[model samples]
Target: MIEADRISKTYARGVYALRDLSLRIDKGDFVFLTGPSGAGKSTLLRLLLRRDVPSEGQLIVGGRNLAELTPRQVQAYRRSLGFVFQDFKLLQNKTVLQNVALVPRVLGMPPSQQQRRTFQVLKWVGLQHRMSAYPLELSGGEQQRVAIARAIVNDPVIILADEPTGNLDPDLSLEIMNLFREINARGTTVVVATHDRELIRRVGRRSVTLNHGQIAELA
Candidate 1:
């Protein structure tokens, strides 16, 4: 469902975030992206999400070229994929339900349908009881669960998570990982970028490792 061919990103001052990296992820496959800091994992994720374009080569999603897409098309393409971030980028001022409902609302979904999906996904993430709580009122793990709910509420075909377990303890991290595994088992393609070696080992899926802007290993 996703393909990157010789993709590279070079910023100003000669810093290359990614270098000639090519990878393919098929539909319903779960893959782990792992590397040290400054290893270009985040850059790769950004390219996939169209948050940043590669300075060289091609990125194709669902058979559409990301490099050639217009802004409107990029937005439309993103609607097919879900993104989770390390920081849990929830709106502090919005209630959990409202925050989870934002994307469907933007797509002009009916109120009843949006509410139904939001509640269902929040429940799946084990945060249904916290639906009315604001971000600050919840613990770190709870906030991350809310973020997960928001990502999957649309039932996107691909789920991309950048360091989704970075801030939690081992037990809590395992809980979140199990949630991701469940989603992957249900036929959603799951790609997670993380530095947690133990977690990666525990999960035991194929992993692509980036080092010095290039893919140093893949297993």
Candidate 2:
């Protein structure tokens, strides 16, 4: 579960990315964060991931106050959640399997377990056949699928995807959305930040809309 209480993020030049934003996402819920560019969608996600600290207010994720965590604890906290980005962010030099295996490898998971989980998740995303391919060798949709596989390989408590389907075709976008739905059904909390209104409407999940750095609607 995640809670943000009157959180605000201000950058150096007197610019505010979020203004007194308050929201709560319960465990096992799927939510869409829809807003135009500069509306604080990515800022909120970054705050949740502890990639950046809020300039004001509090953020609690999985019962731990983000503001109070030590640097070491922040690293551990990140491992408990998965992040997927608009750009796939796959390593161009690493093979699909290796890229997906990076997290567990970094966490000191045993080689056998890493191999097993990586392969299993690749299959889940229907990319098992392309495991040995590099990022540039695959299509855009394939690359995103690999990203999804990498995100879920560790079975994190929550998944935060920022414009996950931003680069794919409409059909592929729907495919990715359905994949997120499936992941949500399996009990992982999922929050996606996107401006794709058509996709959001098609999915029909609870949506929160932001305008001018503040939540304007929740439906």
Candidate 3:
């Protein structure tokens, strides 16, 4: 679960990115954060990822308060989370298999286990057949699937996606959203920040719409 307790993020010169916002997302929930650019969507996501701490209040994920974690605790906490981006950040030089296997390898999973896990997730995302392909060699949609595979390689408890369909066409965006829905069905919490209203309506998940750094609407 994610709980933002009246959190506020103040940027340079006291600009408020998030202003005393509070929210709760339960486990296994799939929620969309939609708003205009700079509506504090990304800022809230950054705080949830612990990339940036709130200027005031707290963020708690799975009962852990982000503000009080030790550095090592922070790293461990992050391990339980997955993040996807608007841009597929796969290493250009790496094969699809290598890219998906990265996190397991980094954690010193034995090479054999890493290969198994990588193959498993790649199959999960329907990219098992593209294992030998490089990022540039794949289509845009395929690259995004590879990115999704990489993100879920750890079997994270929560999946946080930032504009995941921003670069895809309408059809491809729906395909990606379907994949997310499947992931959510398996019980991982999913939070997506996107600007596509049509996509949001199609997904028809509960939504939180922000305006000027506050919760302006909920649907």
Candidate 4:
């Protein structure tokens, strides 16, 4: 669950990315964040991930106030969340299995557990056959699926995807969305930031629209 209370993010020279933004996302919920460019959707996600700090107000994720966390605790907190990006962000040279396995490997998971989790998530994303392939060898949709696989391999409590389907064709976009929905159904909170209105309408999930760095609508 996430709670943002009047949170505002201001960059150097006093440019505000978000202003007095307040929102709450409950556990086991799926929410869509839709907004125009410069509307602060991405900024909000960054704040939630502790990648950036709000210049004002408070952000509490999974019951801990983000502002109060120690550097070590911030690292630990991020382990409970997953992030997918508009760009796949896969290592060009790493094989599919290795890419998905990196998170657990860094966390000091045993080799056996890492292998098992890597295979399981790749299978979940329908990429079991491509585990040995490199990122360049896979199609765009396939690469994106691998990214999703990597994101979920840790069994994160929440998944935050920013324009997850931006590079795929319509069918593939829907496929990716369905995968997120399936993940949500399994009790992981999912929040996606996208500009694709038709996709938003098609999915029919609760959507919060931002305009000028504020919540313009929530439906």
TM-score of each: 0.98, 0.99, 0.98, 0.99
lDDT of 2 by residue, 190-215 (tens): 99999999999999999999987899
Better of 1 and 2 by TM-score: 2
Q: Which pairs in model 1 have colliding backbones?
A: none
lDDT of 4 by residue, 38-140 (tens): 9999999999889988999999998899989999999999999999999999998899999999999999999999999999999999999999999999999
TM-score (C-alpha, index-matched) for candidate 4: 0.99
Across 1-219, the per-residue lDDT of candidate 3 in tens digits comes to 899999999989999999999999999999999999999999999998899899999899999899989999989988999899999898999999999898999988999999999999999888888899999999989999998988889999999999999999999999999999999999999999998989999999999999888999999
Evaluated against the true structure, the overall lDDT of model 3 is 0.93
Better of 2 and 3 by lDDT: 2
| CA error at residue 18 for candidate 3, angstroms | 0.5
Error of 1 at 206 (Å): 1.2
lDDT of prediction 4: 0.94
lDDT of 1 by residue, 136-199 (tens): 9999899999999999988899999999999899888889989899999999999999999899
Superposed by TM-score, candidate 3 places the C-alpha of residue 208 at a distance from the truth, in angstroms, of: 0.4
Q: Each candidate: RMSD to true structure?
A: 0.8, 0.7, 0.7, 0.7
Candidate 3: 10-residue stretch with minimal lDDT: 121-130
